[model samples]
Target: MTDSMSDTLNNEIIVPTMAQMAAEGKQPDILFWVGCAGSFDERAQKITRDICKILQHVGISFAVLGTEESCTGDPAKRAGNEFLFQMQAMANIQVLDGYNIKKIVTGCPHCFNTIANEYPGLGGNYEVVHHSQLIQQLINEGNLKAEGGESFKGRRITFHDPCYLGRGNNVYEAPRAALEVLDADLVEMKRCKSNGLCCGAGGAQMFKEPEPGKKDINMERMNDVLEANAQVVASGCPFCMTMLSDGVKHTEKEQEIQVLDIAEITVRANGL
Candidate 1:
């Protein structure tokens, strides 16, 4: 982690995506980091808590760095606010160091990307895993099992990939794996994975009004779900869930469809 790396962490310089952030490493055992999106959104917060609850049920003891949690500077970096991104990154690094936390799990794809991929430039490096990945591991280890009785019984559904998680981070399968564990009828959108469309809420779009475009990014994605005839649209990222839910509202598709996070869907499946 050099200053140049730190400087370029959010400098919009070409670099590896979030999927390549962890090559091999040792990590701390306690802290699970939740980014601003997870903290700020009630639905995301519920998902985070649900993850923690599931992990705890499996005998994993972890602490949430709530007050110490700050923006990962991802939005700022994406919006060309380099100074703010740098400052926020530094503050996050300092907070992590204060807790001697060397590992983190995040529910937000943007946070996971910044902390895992970009933080090394600022000399802040840690083993970061997305919550879905961790949950998958737990299920594989038999620590957590999906309650297959009546919770997961539902109509057909499709998943919308968040840019940071699906394209930016290359994490297409983990959330799907979690869904599969719950016996979800996973239907793929025509445009999925790295090719998935934006949710109209990334790159700081959540903070400001959306720019004019032929079609709303989120609406375009919702139309894909509608085309699939999916009754439920599932997503992992909060931003994606929010934007897509909005899209459903904007398109007046809520009557015909429902939006849910992977965690929420899983929790329902588990009868929790």
Candidate 2:
């Protein structure tokens, strides 16, 4: 990792796009699919950089789609706009296949689910894994061990499974697998794993405002975090991070509790 991890890309870190690699007659080991949030959202971009850092740390050959990348059509599909989804999906598939991309790794579970599950049917078959799963694999392979990691012993940590990652795709253990690598006191909210509660951002709920007069779903979910008595809430999705962070802010837990994406935590734990 370089000083540019928190800022814009710099020469110190080699972050070539698929187009650049292809133009150079190169094929990276994996296509890092930085989804909408990871690409544009300021906070999510930090997680994106951390993920890139981790891949670089492990000496994995990877390239991002960069200017060529498009939305995986998750929000459109989740919002019940199939036509728009197909259009977006096809465009992405064309770009991905043009680069001869075979394996993909994403920071967003929505992209992971859409590309891994939906793209195959549209003639875009490829192996896709979320960053959490990749982190688990890297740790398992002895490539990453969080050598100089932070141990949240005093303020226990808990993981909030993204709805798309958990129920939509049944990825229960990977996020925890990534978080557990750190020497931290990890716990679980009452509703976790298969029974995890949504952070009020699933099915494209993130875009529109919640219906008036109803208690916000994220607020209700934050109650679970409070009950767990966790000071740090680890999540794997950027959408969930926004909602959870809003919850912490709404409840005025800024100084006491914090919401972090798995990649961010991994970067910090490993002193990346």
Q: Which candidate is the best by lDDT?
A: 2
lDDT (Cα atoms) of all candidates against the true structure = 0.75, 0.88
CA RMSD of all predictions: 10.8, 2.9
Evaluated at residue 136, the lDDT of candidate 2 is 92
**Residues 1-272, candidate 1, lDDT per residue (tens digit)?**
24323433333222221222223332325567767767778867777766655544454545667565788999999999999999999998987876667778888889989999999999898989888788778778876677743455556778888888888888888888877776656788889888888888988999897777787778778778888888888888888878988888988977888888877776666644
Which 10-residue window in model 2 sums to the lowest lDDT? 3-12
- Candidate 1 to native Cα RMSD, angstroms: 10.8
Clashes counted in candidate 1 amount to 3
TM-score for each model: 0.85, 0.94
Best by TM-score: 2
Error of 2 at 132 (Å): 0.4
What's the lDDT of the predicted structure labeled candidate 2? Answer: 0.88
